[model samples]
Target: MKDRQLYQQILGITTPWFVAEVELDLEAEEVHVHLAHQQASWPCAECGKPCPLHDHQNERTWRHLDTCQYRTLLHAELPRTRCEEHGVRVVDIPWAESYGRFTALFERLVIDWLEAASQQAVADRMGLSWDEVHGIMQRAVKRGLKRREAEPIPYIGVDEKSFRKRHRYVTVVSDINRSRVLYVSEDRKQTSLDSFWGTLTEEQLDSIEGVAMDMWEPYIDSTKEHLPEADEKIVFDKFHVAKHLGDAVDKVRRQENKQLREDGDDRLVGTKYDWLKGRDKFNHKRWRAFCRLRRSNLKTSRAWAMREQAMKLWDYCYPGAAENHFRWWYRWATHSRLEPMIDKAKMLKSHLKNILTYLTHPITNALSESLNSKIEWVKYTARGFRNRDNFKTAIYFHCGGLGLLPAT
Candidate 1:
């Protein structure tokens, strides 16, 4: 049968019902669909009036799933209705919303592929522009947000990551147990956290028993202010604490290495140098240097002594020695003549409650970091997000764990 006749037959326009027909133009590499209206009247929304259908308008085409080698376009002759009570209005169709050219299924498919794949990649595969794919994703995000209004998230982890060379940072919050991002803010500030506080109630905050953070003042301040009576105790993650000490140790080691190089100690440059990496990864050579420094009894070897002290500080962090370790550190800090090391130890000991809590409940903000990695991947894959809403939508759809399929 001819394409036009086939389209008319499938559309069933002769019966004057509300349905659409499909026409496959194989030779032209196009599939055209026509939506027909059987009723010529619509009741006014504001005023009860049977509006008469005026005339068929221009063809509105929407991209659809491909048919074999041909691309499909859903074309409909949208009509305007003239009502006595209300002004001229566009007729509503059940297959697609007014002013929306794409079918619901087609939009879902595009958004699904976009959530799993990059915008550019989806555009390239579907022969669409990046803008179109992004538009679909933005719409999907809005829809998802509406559906997720009643979701209950108990434990949330918040952290920040640098973007655009550390000048611009984005704060990300995630569900720790579910391993998904709940939201992302423009800045890492207390105000940024305030944006989502309304999403949770006091009961929810009180339910949180633990919050893992990296010893950032803003996060700590915000949590305290927002959840003043929360049962959640702030746990300074062990990884970050260890990182701080490791960084300090590395700085000291580098200074020592620089001094050796300046003094023409080339014999101690290579093999002897590996001992100064960090206290955590200290080798046999490092242990030997530490022993030598502890036993040297030389006032000039302060750096070597400091390195030994740093090693001892790390040694106190060994597993299964929590009580003994705290006692040892307390005694060392109280009696030590080295004021600098003692000061550091005292500062750490002051937060011993949180530190010991970490030993017992070892939950970290690593899930938040992992979610940030995925957000970074989305940012890089798209090269950039021009629309903030679309960027947010993509993030929520991809990582919100709402069980929403891209095809939905």
Candidate 2:
């Protein structure tokens, strides 16, 4: 077959659009396939009404899939139609989407490579600029998010991810059951989380069974305002509760370690991490040493014991039993004379209703945290995004579990 016919077959070029000419620049190592349109009336790009072809658009080119190790490009002077309602608009082409600088197949290739490597790396390998690669990513994510179904995720998580240094953050809402991000907003503000609730339908909202999140007041207030029976559905993540207690134990250790060292009792001097570590984390040697420390009459030990007991409360299969366990644990901490433990215990008490909901909902932000780690890896691989919009785009592109592919 001739090169034009071969390219036509290769490109699956149809009646209205065909490869009119083919040029191979051996020195440049590129294949150029120029396209042309036959005499035909075309439908309006906006309203799909049949209209006369008024004129040809300015010549445009698209990066296409490489042909036999040679970079390929498609050049076309697309037809324009004067629609009565929508005015003169460029008609859609067969080989590429409107406004796209790359063919569908080429964009698909970029999407596949992007999932495995950083954008810069993909751009370098694909012979494209960083901005071009990012534009493809933006378009792919936009397509995927637009195509996403209105189905509600039965269990969800709302979490925060650090944007850049200096305490900047973005809120992420993920489908806990499927482990995909659903929404991302600019900050941890009440309005930030409130935006997510607005996207759900009454049916979608009603279908939501639970939301696992940290007890950030903004997030709590937002969930309460949107979800009915929010008390039962909002599960304060168990890990967050554990973090609160862990922090309290660390504070107790710091103060007591100073007092013990000043009195020449150096037992607590270098055990900062030991006190902070979970019980099972200790190996045999460290476990034996930690056992002796816990056996001592140190205020930090008592505080550690309270923290450990509170963590164990998560094992209860029933909410009532768990609540009772927390009450006993709370009483112990409040009367234990450790101000840090007392303060943390009181805070947990105030959020106890939602904390105990974990027994029934049995959901946590574990997957959200896991996805956050993946986002951190993406950010690190990209060496950090330039701004929040770019960062948000990167998050949706990488961690949203989106079907980010051009329809080739």
Candidate 3:
């Protein structure tokens, strides 16, 4: 079929709706189209009044998909309608909004691309400005959010991620089993989670069996308050628990290092000092000064012994050995002469109930972390969303498991 005939078929205009005959030029790799309006009347959008259509007010054209290197243009003539309530206003078409010239399907394509790709890239490829592409994304996000509000989630995993270089952070909540985000709040405070509590029904809150979180007290307190009967069992993720022990070990090592420096032990100051630093390298550089103390002439056999004992806690040979290992560690730590290590061991034993829960259900907040990564991607693509409503919608559409397709 010819290009013009094919374009007409794609538009699907027959009799009742108005049609425009336009000529498209793609020699310059840019859209150029001339449209002639077909005289027709449209109803007022506000009051559904059968208002008389005025003369063609203006001709607007938008860049659409390129056909085999040929630029496509959607040209339309906008007309006004005289409504007694709304006065004189531009008529709204089912295919496009009042001020918009592109068809609904065309808008959907832009939004889908925006979701997956960066705004600057989408704008350059579609021959549109960055603001135009962002606007379409904003609209799509709103529509998606509205659809998601119809259904609510039961089990939610709440966690926080850094938004800035320092301590500034944001909270994100997701469905643990479904593996989708439920909501994201601007701040990591209890108030942020409180704001979303209104959106959840009482039955939904009651259905939540357990909530996986870090050692943050605010999160635990808020969860308990909101989900009063929700198992009341907080599973402190293994990673966070391990991190605490690691920090304590480093602290003791630092104290021992200062005492060794007083005795002028220069041999313990350089490399080949793996024993003092331990295996975890996340904060190795910060704790290097303490690692040197391991070789100090000062009495540090107790500190060294505690470090080795702490490392042994992670040693689980098989599936059934976890309980036995926990019991063994309990006995060993309590009998130790080192007070600091004994204190930490006692704290661990106090939380043994929640710690052993991991053996029954070995799930962590890793799924929630994965969802936060996606949210970070969205923030980077748009360079941060100005509208909170639009941001929520975009998160829900992409991570809410709504299975929402683009407008087309």
Candidate 4:
């Protein structure tokens, strides 16, 4: 086949465009393929109505995928058409999106590389600058966001993650049933989640049935403000509640250990994990050690028992039964003489309805937590993002599960 035909086939040029010429510069190790319009006049980019040729714009060059060992470039004369309805506008090209300096195929290759590797790695491998690679990613994310269909979210998990250090955070909302990130925005404030709710259509907002989240007031407030059935839909994650109880247990353990140290008693020494770890996770030796602690009169021992009993509250089939169990456990914890345990019990009492809402719909933020872990991995892989926008984009790109492939 001739060089022009080979170039045309390689570049996927067809219809309104074709590879008119090929210039192989061995000195520069580059392949320059010149493109030409097949017709003298074409449809307007704005209105899609065929119009007489206004004039041809200056030659524009787009970077293409490498040809074997050489860099490939495509040069074309972009035409402008004056539509009566719309003023003079440049006609759209077939092989590339408007205002893009790289061909669609090249951008597609970059998208695959970005999924597999970091932007820096891709830039290095492709001999492109870091900004160039980031631009490609930004454009790809824009395309993906545009292409994504906004379906009604029935079940969602809301959480916040640290973007950089010093308490910098971003709120992430995930479709729990679909196990994909639905929206992300800066800050852990109510406004952060408000942005997400604002984007949803009325039907989409009404379709939401459940939202699993940690006991963060901002998230709760946002849900109450936006969701019609906040009382019924809001579910405080079990793991988070368990975490508070666990923290209270550890606090009691630390205080007891300190008191024991003062009294010259070594009974609670080296037994931190005994109180925190689950009984099922204990080995024979650890179990024996925990048994000894359980039998002892340490305040931590009572706190541990209370924590275990509270975990059992989730085992009840009915929400009323669970609430009753929690109330009994709350009475025990509040009277246990452990300040931390009392505080945790009081907090749970305040949020009991949201906690028990879990029984009606057993949804957990496990998937959201899993997504946070993956986002952390993405952050670690990229050695941390310099800005919140990049961090948000990275999370969406990696965990959003957005279909990012370009049109063929």
lDDT per residue for candidate 2 within 1-408, as digits (tens), equals 247988988877788888899999999999999989785689998988999889998899999999988899999998999888888989977678999989998998999998889988998999999889999999999999988888868999999887678588899999987788899989899999999988888889989999999989999999999889988899999888888888999999999988988899999878988988766898999899999999999998999889889888779998788888988988888999899999999998998888888888889988566787888887787663688888888889998888888775
TM-score of each: 0.72, 0.95, 0.68, 0.95
* Residues 245-353, model 4: lDDT tens digits: 9999999889888988999998888887777777688989979977977988878888888988988877878988888898788889888878999999999999989
Could you arrange the candidates by TM-score from highest to lowest?
4, 2, 1, 3
Give the alpha-carbon lDDT of every model: 0.62, 0.88, 0.63, 0.86
Query: For each predicted model, how many residue pairs clash, with residues at least 3 apart or on different chains?
Result: 2, 0, 0, 0
Q: After superposition, how far is residue 397 of candidate 1 from its true place, in Å?
A: 2.9
What tens digits encode model 1's per-residue C-alpha lDDT throughout 275-306? 34445676788768756653654322443444
Task: Report the alpha-carbon TM-score of model 1 versus the true structure.
Answer: 0.72
Number of the top-ranking candidate, with TM-score as the measure: 4
Q: If ranked by lDDT, best first, what sequence of candidates would result?
A: 2, 4, 3, 1
Question: For candidate 1, what is the total of clashing residue pairs?
Answer: 2
Task: Report how far residue 161 has shifted in candidate 4, in Å.
Answer: 0.4
What lDDT is reached at residue 189 by model 1? 83
RMSD of each: 6.0, 1.9, 6.5, 1.8
Worst 10 residues of 4 by lDDT: 376-385
Segments in model 3 whose C-alpha atoms lie over 4 Å from true places = 1-4, 10-15, 23-63, 67-71, 77-94, 97-102, 149-154, 231-233, 261-361, 372-398, 402-404
